[model samples]
Target: MKRVGSFLGDWWRLVIPYFRSEEWPIAIALLIGAIALTFAGVGLEVLFNDWNRRFYDSIQNKNETVFWREIIFFSWLAALYIMVFVARAIVSPYLRLRWRRWLTSHYLAHWLDDRGYYRIELTRAVDNVDQRIAEDLNQLGQYTMTLLLGLLGAVATLISFLFILWELSGPLSLASIGIDITVPGYMAWVCLIYAVVGSYLANLVGRRLIPLNFMRQRFEANFRFSLVRVRENAEGIALYHGEKREADSLNARFIDVFNNGFRVLMTQAQLAFYQSGYAQLAIIFPYVVTAPRFFAGVITFGVMTQTASAFGQVQTALSFFIDNYTSLAELRAVMDRLKGLQIATDEKPPTAIEVMPQPGRSGVATEDLTLSLPGGQALLENLDLPLEKGQSVLVRGASGTGKSTLFRALAGIWPFGRGRVRVPEGARVLFLPQKPYIPIGTLRDAVRYPDENSRASDADIAAALQATGLGHLTDRLDEVAHWSNVLSGGEQQRLAAARAIVFKPDWLFMDEATASLDDAAEATVYNALKKQLPGTTMVSIGHRPTLRKWHDRQLELKRAPGEVGTLVEVPA
Candidate 1:
């Protein structure tokens, strides 16, 4: 019961936001319309049940006139039922789509706001966030609406038919068995007990499905992600002739998917076996129980059939949980995943590193800054580095000495550290990693990335590309393609240089951004930056000796084994 309550609470938290969103007026109106159609459909069932009694009675009495009239009545009832069903079908899915759109937008904002996505990746807090946003949110909206409307319809059917069934069932007498006992509304009682037992057994048989479904989604997503990774790195793998090894890794991931999928299939098979048998038995069980009254001449055939029809409706309503247990389990799993994502995005992890903005400050500086690994081991300790405006600085260190991590700290993305990084207020900063991110779009968009709204003219973009020796790509600026996969390493780095030239940040930090380029091309790119963005402060992290000449000063990180790296000023 506690677990059920908790699940409902989580599900409600996920659902209620949409109804309260800016689209609430339309959302609520459509929901109300869907619900009205559901109840109206249930009302049609009651009318149909009454028509069943009259139509069968007229047939029993051989009254062709009344029989024909009931047929006409049934046609009208059937028409109304069809209309209600159609209306519900239209409104419900429309509401689901609109709700999903709002939810997608809301979650996207939360995930992307304030670099929450970056922190989530850094901490490894959740798995397959893309799946969560793309697939799970859609499923959540779909299942929640389907289940809620189904449940409301069930309750209405149960309430409407319970009274009709009670009145029609009358009483069961045990006088024939020598006991003087009369049970009133016996069929209603039987239905309640039968449905209760069926639901309990269904839950018992399918309880494992919740975790199985959860793991199934995870394993499937993991397998898909592995395939995408292989595709993304196809060049590296093909160059190394690692297809056999890649196949082995991919097969390993699929094995997890296959094993869990098999478990789900088997479990669903068990539930299906029980559900099918239970449903088939329900068809005749009502007749079997009500036939005695018909045979004894206590009720007409019409009364007996009406009693049976009412029994079926009441039983179906009571057995809603039994019928939908699998869907319930799946919805629970989706709720758990979405709830976890919500919590992860909402979490405000204590910041060990503090970044402050000083309005009049000339450049970026760190005070008592200590950088650490995720495991809390210090990488750099007690570092006080002040980078003044327009001063080109080169940062050099042995491999794995936290040079790139320092860049991340300055960019204010790395969180596993304690420090005060003060940046000049309103300063435009950009960090270019070794392998720059080239978004999948037109080359114009890629060159102007992180500044998608830049008003840089095509002529300016072409000039920047030519300046970086990528004059060939200038013609393809409007050509749309996956630039990251399409361009070579050197070309991609040059493209990154083109972006730097085009955007021209106030402070530019490059972590081996030019490592892929040859010395001549690299010098050309650096000279272009110097000549074009003369006032920009440049911080470069590179191993190339030729890189020193472009910088005004140098800082080297030196450390012994098991000691934190300390930054020292060195001659350029």
Candidate 2:
């Protein structure tokens, strides 16, 4: 019960926002309309129960006029019933889509807003964000609709039909014990007991499914994510001859999927055994209980028929939880995932090394700067540095000395220590890593990324491409393809350099950007940058000794035991 309440509490957090937003009026009206239609449908059901008694009486008496009159009445009742169901079906899904759209956009905005996406990927290293957005939000909205609508219908039906059932099954005695247990609503009490027992038993059979379902979804998403990662990095994996290892890893994840799925099947099987049996036995149980009253002539076949319908409705209402418990559990699971994503995205930046980029054209400046890891291992501590326009510096260090990490700090991404960094506000700053991100779009857009609407002409973009010796791509800018996979490693780096040449940012930082390029190709690109953008300042972190000629100065990092961070110095 506590767990279920907690689940509902999370669901409310997810659900309540939509009704309170701008859609509140329409959503409320549609909900009220749907509920009214349902009540009308139930009203028709109660009238039909009366018709069952009268129609059965007419048939027993062999009266043609009464029978035909009742047929006409039922035809109208059937049409009314059909209209009610049709109205609900039409209006409910519209509401569902509205709610889903609002929630999807809300989550999408939160996930992508203000560098949350990059921070989570780099800092937390949590995988499968795409799955969380695409799959989890969709399922959360869909299941929330299903559960809410089901609960509304169940509650309405229970209230309307329980009274009918109390009137029909008559005063009661315990026949098994032959004792007078004089309860006015004995049949209602009987139903309450039966429903409570069935629900309790069903909970026992299905209680483990909630966590299992949650794990299954996460596992499935993870496995799918791995497959996509392999596809995206197929060339890298192939170059490393990692197909066997990849297959083994993928198979291990799938095995968990298979085992979890099998467990769910077993559990559902257990739940089904009880549910189906209860429904089947329900067919005869009401008749058996009221049989003595019928034989004593206290009621006719008509009453017996009406009484049976009322009993079924009551039992159906009572058993709703038993039937829907599993789905409710899954609904909660999806809610939990969305909540997790929200929390992960909204977490405050670490207070230690977080550097804020200030607005200036004074060039990149840092005052009393310190950078540290989240674990408090200093990358660079108590360091002060200034680089202005036309200054090119190379940051050099042994591997794992946090050369790249300090660049992240300057970019305001690695926020684990205390520092202040000042840079030109609204100044175009670009970071080109060892491998550039090739967005899946036209080559032109990918090259001009983070500058999607830049005023750079096609001729200029084309000339930049030709300068990189990728003249073939000069005419293919408008043509769309996955350029990352289409181009070779060296070619992609050349393309990345071509972008830097094209965008001509005031400041450009490259972290091992030429590691994959040969010495000749690397030198050609850096020399081209100097010729093309004479005023642009480039800070590069590279291991190649040949790179020293392109830069006027170098900041080399030193790491030692018992030391927390890298020490930086400007070489003569």
Candidate 3:
């Protein structure tokens, strides 16, 4: 009971937001209407149970007119039932869709806001966030609709059938059991006891399903994510002839999925055995209990049949949780995933690296900066550097000398550090990583991304592409494709250069941005930047000796015996 209570509490916290969202009016209205129709369906079921009694009694008595009249009555009831059922089916999905759209939008906003996605990656707090937002959110809608409607239907069935069961079932005197008491509503009591015992047994058999379902989702997502990773790195794998290795890794992940799935199937088979027998036995148990009265001439066939129908309805209502145990377990897992994602998204990035925007201040500078790796090991400490306006500086160092880490600290994204980075307020700055991000879109969109909606002119874009030696792509500006996958590594780097020509930022930081290109091609990009954005304060991180001519000054990171690395000015 405590576990169930906790689950409901979590479920309510995850789901209540949609009901209070801007779409709540229509969502709530549709929910009420659907629930109302469900009750109407339950009421129609009661009418059918009563109709069964009269219809069968007329047959037993060989009455033609009454039978025909009851048949006509049943036709009306059936038509109304179908109408209500269809309307419910139509409206419920529309509501689910609307709710899902709102939730997906909300989650996306939260996940993308303030670099929440990046922090989640750094923390590793949750896995397969893509699945959580995409698949689990969809499941939330599907299972929420099914479970809520099923519960409401069950409640209505119980309300409408319990009275009929009570009146139809006479008091059973316990004379045979050597007791004097008479039990009223004996069939209702029997059904309650039967459903309770069945529910207890079903829970015992199915409790393992919750964690298995959770692990199954994780394993399946892990396998799928691995496949996506392989697809993304297909070129590297093919070049290295590592397909066999990747295949083995993929198979290993899938084996986890396969083993867990077998466990789920085995447990489900056990549950199905018990539930199937319980349900089939329920069909006959009511008649068996009422048989003595009917055979002893105390009641008619119609009454006995009506008692059976009512007992079935009541028992089904009471056994709602038992029947939906597996689905409920899956739903629990889905809700837990979404809740974890919500918590992760809400977490703020570390403030260890502080970025301050100083209005009217030109260029970028850092004061007494200390940076550390994620494992609490210091990389650089007490580092101070100041860059004046319009000066091109190149940063060079051996690998593992904290060159890229310093750049990250300056960009204010490396969280495990203590530093103050001062950037001129309202100044546009851009950071180009080694492998540039080319969103799957048109050539123009990919070049203009992080600012796709900016008011850059077409002539400007074409000129920038031509200036960066990508004149061949100028004609394909309107073509939509996965630009990253379609373009070669050198071409992608050239595209990043073209972006800089278009953006013309006040400051630019490049971390091995031209590593993929030939020295001659790399020189063309640097020359284009020097010629085009002369006043832009540029900082480049590279190892090529040929890059020295473009910069006015160079900063080199040199390691001491035991202290963090030191930054010193080197002759350009």
Query: Which candidate tops lDDT?
Result: 1
Tens digits of per-residue lDDT for model 3, 220-335:
99999999999988899999999999999999999999999999999999999999999999999999999999999998899999999999999999999999999999999999
Which segments of candidate 3 are over 4 A away from where they belong? 559-563
**Ranked candidates, highest TM-score first:** 1, 3, 2
**TM agreement with the true structure for every prediction:** 0.98, 0.94, 0.97
Which residue runs of candidate 1 sit more than 4 Å off their true CA positions? 560-562
Greater-TM-score candidate between 1 and 2? 1
Candidate 2 lDDT over 412-520, as tens digits, reads 7776677687787777788888888888889888778767678778898888888776888887888889888899988889889889988888898999988888888
Which structure among the candidates has the greatest TM-score? 1
RMSD of each: 1.3, 2.2, 1.6
* Tens digit per residue, CA lDDT, model 1, 1-572: 99899988898888998888899999999999989988898999999999999999999999999999999999999888888888888999999999888999999999998788987898888899999899999999888888898999999999999999899998888898999999999999999999999999999999999999899889989999999999999999999999999999999999999999999999999999999999899899989998877898989999988988998899899999889989999999898888889888887656567889898888889999988877677888878898988889999888888888998888888878887999998988889999899999899999999896899999999999999999988899889998889999999999999899899899999999999988999999999999989878999997678999999999898867667888889964
